[model samples]
Target chain A: MIEVRGISKRYGNLQAVDNLSITIEKGHIFGLLGPNGAGKSTTISMMCGLINPDQGQVLLNGNAPGIKETKHKIGLIPQSIALYEELTALDNLSFFADLYNLPASQKAERMEWSLAFVGLQDRAKDAVQDFSGGMKRRLNLAASLLHDPEFIFMDEPTAGVDPQSRNKLFESVFELKALGKTIIYTTHYMEEAEKLCDRVGVVDKGQLLALGTVDELIEQYGGESRVHIKSEQGEESFMTANPVNDLMTRLKGLTTVENLSLQRPNLETVFLNLTGKQLRD
Target chain B: MMKAVVALMKKDLKLLFKDKMAVFFTFIFPLLFAFFFGSIFSSSGGSQGLKIAVSDRDQTEKSQAFIGQLKEASEFRVTETDEANAKKLVRTGKQVAFIILPEGFGENYGGIFSGQPPEILVGIDPARKAEAGYLEGSLMKLGIKRFELAFSDANEMIKQLDFSIEDIQQSDDMPAEWKSLLGDYLPKFKELTELEIAKQPEGSDSSGLSFGSDGDNPMMPLKITKEEITVQKTGPRNSFSITIPQGVIWAIMGCVIGFAISLVREKTLGTLDRLAIAPISRTQILAGKALGCFAAQAMVVTLLFTIAYFMLGVRFDLIKLVLAVLAAGICFVGFMMFFASITKTEQSVAGMTNAFLIIMGMIGGAMIPLFAMPGWMQSISHISPVKWAILAFEGAIWRDFTYIEMMTPLTILTAIGVVTFFIGTRMLKLKQS
Candidate 1:
């Protein structure tokens, strides 16, 4: 539901995003994988109309980003928890709901559903300042969904959240996908992208290095699955260039193999192979 | 657009009310300052009655009469004393000044028309220049009245004889010897000339001028009379009344600084950015913030004035007072927005806002009355928005200003609000870009 075409952004002498292009279908979860300073947030900012790209354009369902109609259909959950600490959870939700121009009659019902969806319904009357970090993260997510925008952009929504809250957030993301909502997710963690995203794009140095599904990416850049074996003699690990069934059958005949396991190429290996394991700012 | 603006305004107000410290500074602190300063500065509610010692060494009826006149003066609190004590009182600052009449003063006073009159000894405190000047003026006026009373008939005779001598000099039938005699008397005629001259007759020639010694034709034709008329008969202004508007200015300034800091905090916390990303225009966001700050300022000012009205006996023209409060609120809201536009962080905005408020308060007569400052400082006071605010408020309160008179300050305040708001919004747009 979003199209980023030849978009490039620069900050002073540093090019933040260089000629980046990406497209997502209406009901898919697209994960943008990148290291720090990889221009992932910059691209998301351009798509949400928060920051204008230095060159090219961002179109949401054929309309430019920040066009009134397009902005009404997009929601952004920033990396930081952007809820008003001084205001109660309900007040914050009500404010964002009003900003989206939601009808007065629908605001309360929608707010109730959003609070329940994020498991913050019990503390809706409490000030957000007194909330736990995880609770605030959930409230931030809930605040974004107040108007139920069709396209949601989440930038590391679970960065500091507890594991339980992280699981809850993941479940919420999957539920949004099941409801046919398009989401653009960016994170430092590769496992989340592998578990939730329908298509993954690996970006580095302001450039897109690879874009594909889990299997497609693994086949293209991840090479082959490896077999690891441990025995009384010594531990041995090797890449199985053949099919996993043949490799397993060949390993079963070895008398020295006391332990056996088949490894599969995942999104992390694919991401590392394509973007390289290098430190970035 | 208005809906979004209203939502933003609601959020701001909510945040402000939730902050207890903000509420206290915005409303309570200024009133406390007003009460403290007001108690110290309130006048005694009447003219400053000057204390003076009077010593009548002459012991004559004329001297006694002069002393009585000084006692009868409502502005002076006169005490009869000996010359030694009078001098001692003035020296010790127990009295503003003292009047001492010498023994031969009444005897030599009648020589004013022919020779110099004896001087009256006035032992005065140099530090009390205003009181000393008043005392001197009072004595001079009394001396003139006594002079006029003592020589009324003699002065009239001198004026008539002088007029006759002038007519004789100009006559064609007069002999040269008589003309020379008139020339010899000319210098003495000038000595007899009165301090005041009446307008001459419309058609009378100089040679035929009338020189009759009429009772009404005195040497000094013009009479000088002192009459005092007060334009505003309101109660005497005490420190409380004067400080009421000043207190209101402080409240408005506090609101401005508080909200300006809040805006910077929101920007730093990413709340402002989140709002910007919504389906709302930049104008809506700014308008919302301005409206919120304006409302808070107006509420604080109103609360302060209400307390002042009941507790301090401050009077007001209800409608004009409301308008003045609104104008001040708008002006400070514009100031808040302007400060927010220029500063990036909460610390920077807070520092600048405090400095600006204190400087404006000091110069604008909020901390001290403008009239008490030097002439140059008073002139510079007009450049402050706080000065215009205080002026507008005073117009509604004790100044008894009419609607037309009130318009000058009100218009100035409104203009400041408008111009600052425009510039602030433009700067904000540029910053955003």
Candidate 2:
């Protein structure tokens, strides 16, 4: 279990993370969604204990995030490559495993298991310098898992990764969740959040704007989805505010409208409608 | 805590080995310096030769003898030249000294020995003053010998004059035998003086009276020898050997600079932030980093030792040599750690550390030997870590100190390392803000 309360972080005069509160139960994937510079990374950094919140406290199972005894209970995967590039995959895994205070006798086993989990067992002997971007990302993820922590904080874990690698990351997150682990995942990709998160928190300008399931958010801000019709020769044109029933009636009435499509707003539209801004910038 | 420390050490080792340029600079370059410096320092031409010039003014048997003495000295090269040429040669740095013998030098003491000091002017170039001084001393000794022989011959000539007994007894200042001789020889002396004065009619008044007024006969047969002996010192004792060892100190300083870069790299790559979140205290992380750096530098020092032994013959007892190297390692590691904690960027760290190393080398005896430096400068060198490190190494090798004799330098080195380590760790702890 992870709990953050009234967390606020100030970088000089700018509030990077405003006073906010959230809780993540065990065995669930919680998504932290935001646009660029929305304090998503700041909040995750605080959760990972890499930064001290100016006016709040974070607890891991009722203990401080980085308390000596509680440190082994959580794992952190940063946005950047954190493993030593010169070290082989096996070497990198073994080092992180040792950091968890794993016994010497168990380190080899843990390293092998972690590498196998990331599907990098064959490339374990090769240096990380030779690994592809996705492979390195997988290895970075594996480094965090070596300690087998109960809860993990991942900051844009799929950013810049290939689709295949991203899918693998999602599968791994689910696998960890299935094993009764808790995950706090931060990302700008709405589809990833919609697919993986049991619940999502939408943050912007260092403040939480909304928090609920994808369906719940759609119901709150969702309006009548419409379909548009157009003709090449300007013979006919039409707009249907209620697309479900009106689509068939309009198509039946307008035989000249050759190109017609329904526009059910995706997450990008949902974000724009709610915030009156593009999701990307 | 121990686990995290090990993890940090392992990570640093991995990164260092991965960097080919870093490996080359930290390990290979120092060996090159050691071989190069050692070969020059241990060369056989410690004090090879000296340049000397001989001014043969008298052109007599005695002058030829003095020139021959200079020529026979293998260490000195005697050049035959006159006073004008000798002075120009010494001034132009072609010769270290010139021996000048004045005119009529051999004839001034033909009869009675009157201790008329033969003045041989030895002109020495100030740049080669010591070498010239050595030659001057040798020439003075030879001149004395020749003058004594001339005096002996003059004594025999006085005996042959044979003065009247009444005139010799009547001379108040004359001893009994010399009085009898002077009384008998007064007319001969007067005749001899007149003849000696007549030989120089143009300037006889000035020359003869100067001799006569000093109670000395100018007719004495004396041999004047002139030899311009210039001594020029040559070999590794010259400028090159002195200047390059100072460069070796800078090379050692480069090791510290390299380690500081490692810290900056850690910061840039976000490894430092990652380590901070691990279950380790800041002090432990700093300790791990410093120890890893010390180990790397110590390995380099060992490589330098081997190179010096095989190529430069820098001899030392293995135990004492290792001890001295250990002391240097401690000081360098501490210095780099402290430097790294204060600096934020790789460029800053590199620039600052290199400048610091050079400054330390300059202040320390590594760049300038303490004996050659001014008093205040020597006192200021004590604060530089390289000063203690160089002193420790030279003490063991050049001073031939036993292990017990190395207490001061070793203690000072350890103390500095400890204090720097403490301060650096404190800085690291405050970095979380």
Q: State the lDDT of candidate 2 residue by residue for A155-183, as single tens digits.
A: 89887899898888888888888989999
What DockQ values do the models have? 0.48, 0.54
Model 1 clash pairs are: B41-B239, B42-B238, B42-B239
Give the C-alpha interface root-mean-square deviation per candidate. 1.1, 1.8
lDDT of 1 by residue, A92-169 (tens): 999999998899889999999999999999999999999999999999999888888899999988889999999999
- What is the lDDT, from 0 to 100, of the residue B19 in candidate 1? 89
Residues B1-433, model 1: lDDT tens digits: 8899888888888888888888778788888888888886664546665788889889987678777877887778899999899989988879888878888776556444332476688777577777777777767776776556543444444544565555666667777887777667754654443312222354432231123444243445454577988786674255677787888888788789888998888778767767877899888889999988988887777788788888888878999999898778778888998999999999999999999889999999998876678999989999999888888888888778899998988899888888888898899877664
Instruction: Predict model 1's lDDT versus the native.
Output: 0.81
True contacts kept of 2: 0.63
- How many pairs of residues in model 2 come into backbone collision? 26
How high is the lDDT of residue A71 in model 2? Answer: 73
